[model samples]
Target: MYAAEEQAKGKPASVPRFSASRRNFLLKTGGISFASALVLAASGCTDNDAPNGGSLTPPNTTAIDLGSGDTGILNYAYALEQLEAAFYTQVIATPYSGISDAEKALLTDIRDHEVAHREFFKTALGSKAIVALKVNFSSINFSDRTSVLGTAKAFEDLGVSAYNGAGHLISSPDYLTLAGKIVSVEARHAAYIRDLITPGSFSSNVDSNGLDISAAPTDVLKTAQTFLTSKLDGSHLPS
Candidate 1:
């Protein structure tokens, strides 16, 4: 939860900064990619165990460690923000040939939201957070409309489930509230993307028991791993 005065610090970056161990963790998890290489080369010794102030360097891999406690929760949000921002940036950069004008507009809004979310965690975390994650979306065929939207829907749904699973682990009421608000929006994105894939797929995929479903971090990260160029260790994050 941003204080009234801090909300004005401008938008946050897509991911949190990292410590030495977390950086090593990301590199181990990240699948090798040209982007990953660039990120690695750029990184150098950053203060470890500081547990405050946002990181100054980009993470060596795509995964976010999140560590423990409220800061970890914020880092989780930051990681999702990076993923969404990366996906949408790619979506906008290489628009599908037959994409409708309306669809493009909606995607743009989604991109903006992701960017804002990314920046929010950065400011909140200040220096303790990991750096912006370097993303590798080469596996995705941006030219194919269905492929792009299908992946987008998966990511959005995963985000909602992830927040639901991890929210309970957060001790801070304010951060938990923020997670709740963000997860609801992610659910909306999931439903909207699902409907786009098929006229009525939204509610169908959503469990009859609830509007949103919870998922352990391992399950959530495993699914997300498909889109990432890095390998992630789910053992450290709250399940």
Candidate 2:
């Protein structure tokens, strides 16, 4: 982990789907402000003014400080949850111009689910969870449907692979169960979005030679590098 940690830094690129059913809500095109509000609300990071480094403060300094072990793995999931929740929340608040009503409604469901999962980890990990990540999506064009869905496909598929690959390193039975629950949902999201991006994309990808396609933490973080602004430390995390 230390050797791998030293040689770090990059960026992640991908797409995600959008949804929600609110008429009163509004967001500027390409603005993540509304999504940030939703994340704060969901993560229970209220605006009443927090201390500089309370228990919720992210221990992560550079990406390398993210650590390995249960803590690192939890933070890894935390990072992904932050990314997904933000993506879907943005999608629903200000959907693509030509998106259908049904698509909007379904996307809303996905957004809520990601929020629930994001909050669940925050609650479960308590003081050990990482802070809300600062993501850069300048590469993704939220205004375009195809770009959005393509990114969604990448995020969902990567998420599934990450959870699958890391299952063995988890120490707590309870946490394993929780991770399983979350991964299953991620898998469903992956499958649905893959089909959306291309009619038969999921058919070959999910069951590709029964290969599982899970990824190592090193690979997962490497793949996710495009969007991350901070460094991930995997030292305390499990190998």
Candidate 3:
């Protein structure tokens, strides 16, 4: 029925269906500003304010140091969480005109989770935490459903792979345990978004060995280059 409806409306068959119920849900939940108030309540960063107040528009820094050893790994994870949180913040702030309530809810949930993750790292790292990263979403078309969902899928998958790759690099058993827990959540996010884009595509990132792809810190930073405006100096991170 969804495919047929899209075809009738001249929309692509590939997109998710937005039924009447979804529209009604949007109207009902429209009063909630999950982007600001709700997210702050959900995140652990509520009490702690960074130099930039966790805003996206922070002063230009010469370079972001990821540090060395376990600290570097944590900073790397923190950086990725920051990027995810920032992206979802923008997604919720300026939702596509046609975005459905279901999309909004899912994206908002993701935003909250990312914010929580970001704060967790910041608190755990304490003085070792890197500055809040400045993101460049100029390449993203926020008003388009395809663009937003596609970008979300990319970030989710990248996050999962990043955790998987960085797991072995972490030396501390406690930090490794924490990373293990977070990676599972990231993988679930990846799967959920993939299904939203195309049903049953949850395993799209799986390789021939039936394992998710992993990347080095250098590789992960390179992939995230397009969305970041600040220069990241991950030179000291573990290989």
Pick the TM-score winner. Answer: 3
Ranking by lDDT: 3, 2, 1
Give lDDT tens digits, candidate 1, residues 1-239: 43233235443322332211122211212122221222222122122323432322234464455654455555666777788888988899999879998788777666656665666556556676667776777778998998899889878878888898877766655556667766766766777788788988777655687556887665666666666664443334443
Global CA lDDT of candidate 3, please?
A: 0.70
The sequence of per-residue lDDT tens digits that candidate 2 reaches over residues 1-239 is 43244225221111122334243221121123333332322332222321121112235545545434555666778888888898888888778778888667667767776876676556545565677888778888888999889888888888889899889877655556667767776776776677766777664564546654688776777767777775665544556
Backbone steric clashes in candidate 2, count: 33
Candidate 3 lDDT by residue in tens digits, 162-218? 999888876666667667767877887788789888999988899999998887777
Off by over 4 Å in 3: 1-61
Candidate with the greatest lDDT versus the true structure: 3
After superposition on all CA atoms, what RMSD does each candidate show versus the true structure? 12.5, 13.6, 14.5
Specify the poorest-scoring 10-residue window by lDDT in model 1.
19-28
Question: What clash count goes with each model?
Answer: 22, 33, 0
- Which lDDT values do the candidates have, in the order given? 0.62, 0.63, 0.70
